[model samples]
Target: MAFWTYMLRCVDGHYYVGHTDDLDARIAGHQSGLIGGYTQKRRPVKLVWWQEFPSRAEALAAERQIKGWSRAKKQALIAGDWESISRLARSRSCR
Candidate 1:
């Protein structure tokens, strides 16, 4: 089965990241508040970005990676600006 890592733009103007094997059902649950948690509390989320992975491990890794990104980087990612995203990523100080 294909695993997907998705990013949601919540009504509160915040972002949510998650991984699932069923993208459609998962997004539906978030929209309907059937999954009561961060996204549910924020409610009425819209999909901003998503990536498909061949393995669950890859999906989970990507989810974690995206979650740690700065808001500017995340926005760049959602905007599909690979150049800016990579530039922001490299600009971060490891210290």
Candidate 2:
């Protein structure tokens, strides 16, 4: 089965990252406040980015990696700005 790693923009302007095999159902749960966690409290979340992978391991790895990224890095991924993403990575390592 395929799995997806996704990012959501919450109502409060924060980002949520997760991996799921059921994309639509998972997003629906988040929307309906049934997820009962960060996005549940934030409410009215919007999908900002996603990537599909052949294996659950790949999707989960991507999710975990993205979760630790800075907001700017997330935005760069959402915007497909590889240069900005690379730059952000360098800046973080330099600090």
Candidate 3:
């Protein structure tokens, strides 16, 4: 069972983070507004980042950790700026 922690860029520019075992179907639900939740009000969502974990626990932990990141750090991650991401992570760890 492959679980994924995904980040979505919402219509209003906010980010949503969640974990699911079904990536494609989950994203579809978000896009179609079929899932009545926070994302539903946000309407269209774009998958800006994702990571695969071998276990559900790992995926969920990563999701929770990412959710705590500042918007700038999150955007850096989404932009694939590994240098900035590493710096942010290290800075956070020291705090």
Candidate 4:
């Protein structure tokens, strides 16, 4: 089974990051508010992005990394703009 790192864009326009072994089930729970957390209150979230990893640890690590990103960086990622993502990272470091 592959582990997944996923991002949800909530109705409030905020993003939530998480890692799970059962991606579909997890997303379903979030959508139904059965998950009962950040996503639950932010209901009607859309699955904006997701990537599968070979291990849970890797997925968790990716989740943590994304959670720290700025909204712009996350948007760049969602748009699959790697160049913009890299530029944003460099700009951050130079600050």
Model 1: number of backbone collisions: 0
TM-score of model number 4: 0.98
| Model 3 lDDT-worst window of ten | 85-94
Question: Superposing all C-alpha atoms, what RMSD in Å does each candidate have to the true structure?
Answer: 1.0, 0.7, 1.4, 0.6
lDDT of each: 0.94, 0.96, 0.95, 0.96
lDDT of 3 by residue, 1-95 (tens): 89999999999999999999999999999999998898999978999999999999999999999999999899998999999998988998899
Winner of 1 and 3 under TM-score? 1
Clashes of each: 0, 0, 0, 0
Q: State model 1's lDDT.
A: 0.94
What ranges in model 4 sit over 4 Å off? none
Query: Estimated TM-score per prediction?
Result: 0.95, 0.97, 0.91, 0.98
**TM-score-sorted candidate list, best first:** 4, 2, 1, 3
Write candidate 2's Cα lDDT for 1-95 as tens digits.
Answer: 89999999999999999999999999999999999989989999999999999999999999999999999999999999999999999999999
- Where does model 1 exceed 4 Å of error? none
**Deviation in Å, model 1, residue 58 alpha carbon:** 0.3
Task: Give me the candidate number with maximum TM-score.
Answer: 4
Across residues 1-95, which tens digit of lDDT does each residue of candidate 1 receive?
89999999999999999999999999999999999989878988999999999999999999999999999999999999999987897889644
Q: What would the per-residue lDDT of candidate 4 be over residues 22-88, giving only the tens digit for each residue?
A: 9999999999999987999999999999999999999999999999999999999999999999999
What is the TM-score (0 to 1) of candidate 1?
A: 0.95
